[model samples]
Target chain A: MEPYPYTVNPFVHQDRFWYPFVSPFDPCPPIRAKRYVVPPNQFLGFQPPNLLQFPPAQALMKGTLWPALFSPYKKTGKVEIKDP
Target chain B: MWVYEKKLQYPVRVSQCNPTLAKYLIEQYGGADGELAAALRYLNQRYTLPDKVTGLLTDIGTEEFAHLEMIATMVYKLTKDATPEQLKEAGLGDHYADHDRALFYHNAAGNPFTATYIQAKGDPIADLYEDIAAEEKARATYQWLIDISDDPDINDGLKFLREREVVHSQRFREAVELIKEYNEQKNFF
Candidate 1:
């Protein structure tokens, strides 16, 4: 199967927002579009809790003052590349 | 993996000290929908995502830390020189009673920041959708803050932060699409 080319423009048929439909009975129909029903959430029987909730108290420690302290660093086995 | 930039993403020079506004603006600093939550959510989610998307999450999440700093700076500047009487007059006595002039992470209502503000679901699509929603909520909160603020310097910072939320939402939408495409490819193979 050929890979589907993705485009930034949402109007393209291949875009995620667009749904594809095929009509067998009628070759051509005015405004040929089918209503798509979204699948119910199987994981959670009821609707999920609201994403927005009240702010909670501070938990995480403040980030370190130095850049190297906040993030991880791994030494490379190879020598460093230089433009000069 | 991360570098500390001395300057803020946007300049914040609050000329006036309004403890009342500080009380409200603290929400963005440590609120449920604030930058701290956003940064944690994305950084935690990055570990489970595909490589490219992980990079996206890491970069955006790091940027959120900067935003968090910017908010903290605003809160500190606003309450710097406020006296107990001035604070009481501006309806910030309760906050001052608790934190004095120091900036502690908490919402406008004085609720402390908690881990519950964010989630790190193993699924990318679900997580991306959640992120989009989070950005929208932050944007709405910034809009509210901007509406109540009269200081040009502070308003300028809030506007920049609000616009960043919109941009983040768009990027998350694209991330959703990318993840979907990856799943489709995996199934095809």
Candidate 2:
């Protein structure tokens, strides 16, 4: 069976005076050539901001999956990597 | 455990105070398909997903948190120096009355954010499909915002975020494929 033919409207209309009345569905709207100028470089550091000062030896571990696979810190202290 | 970053994923500097635009942009900040909802949805769904998919969701969810911060920063800058008269003229009287110049978690129409904005279905396929739709919706909202905004700084930030949504959608589609392959293999046995 052929499906009913219908065209979709990519706009949403709002009746509120405060909000934008019409909104189009183009996620990346084309910017004007002159308006596409880049901002002045502030000479910020290239490296990511490391706000937390953790010890150099401490490895950051995230999520439970890794811990489930293997734990570096063992309760029995059998295979702990000692830093001499 | 998430680490605190002092910087935004994209810079947001609003040179002009446009209370009207600020009101509209608030939708993306805390709306149904907003970054906050996206972050929570993906993070919560990761628990039931397979290892690799869990990692994807975790990373994307973390990125969404940064996007949320960017949106909040834009909103704050827009409303920072706005006078009460200007806010009232911009039809932001009610919002100003409630929270003053401070940023509150609410949509354009002033509805507070709720957990019901997103669903964390245990099924991988269902969750991935939802994530894709969520990304598209967020992209559409950002488009609308970009269409109305004239400021170059705000537009640049919105453009970065809109592109991120598209990328997230593509990644979620790949995750869906992975789940389908896994299911096929499981059924063959």
- For candidate 1, write residues B53-145 as lDDT tens digits: 888898889989989999989988988898899998987787778878888788889889999999888877788889989987887788678
- Model 1's CAPRI class is incorrect
Off by over 4 Å in 2: A1-84, B183-189
- TM-score (chain B) of candidate 1: 0.94
- Show model 1 residue runs off by greater than 4 Å: A1-84, B183-189
Which one is best on lDDT? 2
TM-score of each: 0.67, 0.68
- What would the per-residue lDDT of candidate 2 be over residues A1-84, giving only the tens digit for each residue? 211134422111111112122337656652212111111111112213443433433212211111111111111122222221
The local lDDT score (0 to 100) that residue A80 gets in candidate 1 is 27
